[model samples]
Every structure is written in C-alpha cells, then in structure tokens.
Target chain A: MTTGKGAATRLRIVEAAAAEIRERGANATTLDDVGRRSGTGKGQMFHYFPQGREELLLAVAVHEADRVFEGQQPYLDELTSRAAWEAWRDLIVEQYRDQGLYCPLGVLISDVGRYSPASQAVAAQLVRRWQECVRAGIEATQAAGEADPELDADRTAAAVIGAIQGGVTVLLSTGSTEHLEAGLNLCLDRLLL
Target chain B: MTTGKGAATRLRIVEAAAAEIRERGANATTLDDVGRRSGTGKGQMFHYFPQGREELLLAVAVHEADRVFEGQQPYLDELTSRAAWEAWRDLIVEQYRDQGLYCPLGVLISDVGRYSPASQAVAAQLVRRWQECVRAGIEATQAAGEADPELDADRTAAAVIGAIQGGVTVLLSTGSTEHLEAGLNLCLDRLLL
Candidate 1:
C-alpha cells in the first residue's frame, strides 16, 4: 500500500531506526542517531513524524511487528506435513540464534507497548496473526492425518506461540537457544501425538 | 543480609525506583522521581549508588530478578506432584494476571541486560533457576510414574519456562491471559502424556 518518494524515505527512516533500537535499545536511542543512520535531516524527520519521538517510535513498533512474522514467511506458510514442521522448527532456531540477544519486536513492545494503546494493538495483532498461522498449520497436518484431528487448534497454536516468545526472552538474557528448541520440539511432539 | 538504617534507606531507594519504573517505565523514570518517591535526597542516592543511575538501575535489575522467583516461592519450591503442578500453574496465571501489563523483570532485562554483562548475568541466573525448578518438578512427577520417564527433563523444563515467558509477553501486550493459559496447559499436557 506504500508508494512515492516520500513513502520510500519514510521506510528508510523506519528501517534505520529499527536497526539502531535493535542495537542500542529503545531508551538509549535518539532521533539524532536515527537521522544520522538514515541520512535524513531534522527537517525531513519532522516532516514524516511531526509528533516527534513518539510518532517515530510507534512507526518503528509497527515496522518491527511486521518483521516478526514476515521473517518467518514462506516456511510459516508451508505446513503440509510433519517434515515441513520440522524444517520450520529448524528455521526458527536459526532465526533467533542469528538475531541473538536483541529481539526487535520484544524491545519495541517493552519500550512502547505498555504506555500506548496503539503500540499494544500492534503487538496484539502480531501475536494474533502468528497464532493463526500456527493453527492453520495444525489444521493442514490434521487433514493430512499426521496430527490429531480432534485437537484444539487455537489452544495448540497459542501454546506454540507462547513457547517461542518465552524462548526468545530467555535467549536474549542467556544467549542460548536451548529453550526455544525445547519449546518448539515439545509443541510439535504434542501436535504429533 | 540487609540490616541497619543505611541498608534500610538503600532498600527504600531500590524499591521506590523499581515501583516507579514498573509504573512509568525505565526511560521515563528519573533519579529525581525516585528520590521524591523514596523520600531520599541526592546526597543519599549518590552515597548509596556512587556510579549513579546505571548502578541504581543494575541494583534494581537484580532486585526485580530476585522477585521473579520469590513471588512464586513455596509453590515453585513444592512442584512435586501432578496436583502441585496444577496448583503452581494456577498460581502463575494469577500472579501474572495480577501484575498485568508491566513485567518488571522483562523490562529490566530489555533495558540493561543486552548492554551490560552484570545485568545479563542476573537475567541468565534467573532463567536458570526458574528452569531448574520446573525440571525438578518434572523429575519428581516422573519418579512417581505420573509422567513419561524417558522424557528429557531439562529440555521439557526449558520449553515450559519459555512458554510462560512467551505467554506473559503476549499478555502484557494484549491485556489477556489466554496465551499464558494455553502455554501452561499445553506444556502440562505434554508432561502428563
């Protein structure tokens, strides 16, 4: 839905801000840092985000929220069999491992989600969409006779999402993917059973 | 280990800072705000925390980290049976629900854990201790033959911890406990299976 030179510049600002926040943290990051990283002047930054830091932060929250699922795309969309689930599991492990101790979405939510309803909605929507994808995958697996057809898809999906979220939180703190692997593996085991 | 008037005043500062951060967030919380809330002066704040805000923040991080497991004490300590597990799960749900929208430990880790080794160590230790409790419970359940004996206790515990973390993360964002409930239920189901 985005177009035009202004849209492209806005996207650049958002991306640069997201990266800085990812590295330096939300509280520590300044608009000057974002402007420098994005190669935009104060005038241009204000042009896109007149409400200043809060508006820019909200945009970064939205951007980071989208990336949470977008990064897992194709694999998240493909769930025809037990093998596909396994592959997706591996992808997730690597994804979090590479991202390491800095989880952009988690940081954004913690920084702005509590104080702002709009930011909270972005996080809620992301979680909802993430759970929906997992539920869809479970249904596909059930239809393929690989999973229990009578299983509660919504609960299962919610559990899976929660496990991943928890895993990432631990990973950020401890620099370990063991929890993520365990959570995903256990969720899949339950699904298979 | 704390005693005397000086220790009490230090505790007061840390507690007030934590409460302010919990309500207003870390970035928005100033030392002046903490001093006012705790009825301490700049002299006392600096005397107690010579390195200033970062030192105070690290202390707050440690304080919050300790509280994470302390709140679930006795119950977390007594996860010896299926019944105890269920009780613990309920307690966890109620605890997070009561806390709501503001996870102090999670916020502290996000704010300081990534940049400082001391803060990261505090977070890592908390997660380790948390998983150990869960693993001990799983081991106990297995000993009673209530759970699959061959299940990987460490991994299972990690997954359960992650699920709880994930659930709380979502709950804070959405103001709902569904994900947390789902994560706990699903993990328990797998454990009992």
Candidate 2:
C-alpha cells in the first residue's frame, strides 16, 4: 500500500513534533511550532490532525515509544555472553549521555490532562515490550549457564529495568552519568555474583 | 536584624512558584501564572524579583532542594537498625506515591537554561547534601556492623542513590511503585548480603 503524499506529510508533522518535544518538552512545544518546523501550514496541520494537539501528542507518544526500543537495538536482543551484556551496558550509557538529560518518555507521561487513552496504551505497550526483551536476555543468560539458574528471570529483568530508570532519573537531575554507571555496575555485578 | 516586608514577600513568591512548578512542570508554567497563583501583582512580583522569571525560578530551585532533604527527614537521619531501613523504604515509597510521578527536582534541573546561576548552585548543593545524608546512613549501618566493615561508604552510598533513582524513573514511567520497591529491596538485600 502506497499510503499517499498526504500520509507522508502527516508523518513528517509527527516526526517534527517528536523532535521538538524531545528538544524542549511537550507542554512547551506548540502546533504552530510544529507546522513551521515540519513545513506545513496551520490549515494543513489541522486537516491532517483534526483532533488537534491531543491527536498530535498521541502520535508523538507512539513515535517516542518506538524509538526507545529502536535505540536499544541488537544489544537488547542478545545477552547470552558477558561481552553481549557489556555491549548492551555501553549502549544504554551512551544513549543517555548523548541525550544529556532529556527524557522524552518521561516528558510525555508527566502532563496529566495531555494524556489520551491512545497515548497511555502506547506507553504501556512500550514498557511491556522493553520488559519482555530484558526477560528474554535473562533467559538467554540462564540458558548459557552464565547467570544463576535459580534466579527468577522475571524479577531480575524487572530489577534491571528499574535500575536503569533510576540511574537515568539521577542523570536527568544532576546532568551527570556517574549515578547511571553505578546502577549498571550494581546490576551486572549482581548477575556475576 | 529584622527582615523587611520585601524579603517576606519574596519568600512567599518563591514558595508559591515551587508549589506551582511541582504541580505543573517548569516549562508549562509562566511568570503571570505564578503571580496569579501567588496573589501578587506584576508590580509586586517585579519589586521582589527585579530580574523577573529567572530570579523567581532560582528561588524556587533553592526551595525544592530544601524540600528534598526535608522530605527525607528523621528517617534519612536514622539508619541504625534493619527496622530503620524498612521505615526509610516505606517513607521513600510514600513520598513518590503521594508526589504522583511529578519530580520537582527533575523539573527544576531540566529547565536549567532558564534559571539563574544561583539556581544551578542551589541544585548542585542539594545533590551534595543528599549524597552526604546517604553517606551518613551507610556509615551508621557499618558502625552497627550490619554491612561489610571494609566497604567504601562513599561508593556504597553512591550505588544506593543510583538504585533509588533508577527505580524512581521506572515508577514515573510505569505509574507503578513496584519498580521502586524492587530497586529498594535489591539494594537493601545486597547490603545485608
């Protein structure tokens, strides 16, 4: 299915909105700003997103969710070896370091009135997908006899996710990656022990 | 050595701004909005904070830092027993649950570009103070012979702070306290182990 030029323009608007939201924040970014950035007029933006800011925000939420997993990539997919875990750790650290404290996912969820059901669903789906990937990695490590076989994979996976989030929060607050490094080290050390 | 009414009004303005920032993110808030909420006219607001929004934001930043330590309170001060740790954990959980995912500290730090140099200094001071409290707790626990005697208190404190942050980030993203609980549990568990 070609999906048409109109669909492409709509996507461009959404992409631009997501970028703006990431750079600034959701509440700070306006539709006019999106239109200007995306090269669409005010009328064209409304034509594509009749529901207006709410619809556009939902789209941005989904886009941000997709990027979360996409950014994690092959490292999130494979964690059977120590080398793989180190690679994944490096990727996680680099992602936050490069972004330097802006958390798009956190920003999207912070606004109480801005979240529609669609946005909530996208956020939930993203978490579940991310958790599942971690779970799979834990299972792979267990199967490879690298991690404790008796350790509950689900719990460990949750802990890993929790640690990363905690570390990121600290990074966001202080503009430093030291806390993030500590969290990652603790999780990996626990696994090795 | 009595402070003038001007100083008192300035204090009130800062308090109101901090509350508003806590409820709605820094970017979503405006000087007019803050003045309205604080029951101050533009003239009065400017009279107190001549530099305008940036000065007010810096004031709010300092207020938030105080709140961070104040919220951690007697619990953060007392970590001599296992029971004390549990109480501290409960306090931490309730703090986040009641705050409801809006991290005032994170919000203030996120908009650093819009804040004055004093605001940045306040934030840095807050984190250092927080780390010191954690370090104190670690030292107390070690003195009680609860943790490894030879363990580096600073590093352990850093790890604990990191774990809590990583966990809180997950809680903010998922809207569940489970991750926060897990992170706290893992840290305490490892500390005892």
DockQ-derived CAPRI band for the predicted complex in model 1: medium
TM-score of 1: 0.89
Clashes of each: 1, 5
Stretches of candidate 1 off by over 4 Å are: A1-3, A32-52, B1-3, B41-43
Candidate 2 lands at a TM-score of: 0.86
lDDT of 1 by residue, A72-112 (tens): 87889887688899999998889888865655457546776
RMSD of 2: 3.1
Worst lDDT run of 10 residues, candidate 2 chain A, spans A107-116
Chain A TM-score for model 2, please? 0.86
CAPRI grade, predicted model 2:
acceptable
What are the lDDT scores of the predictions, listed in order?
0.83, 0.73
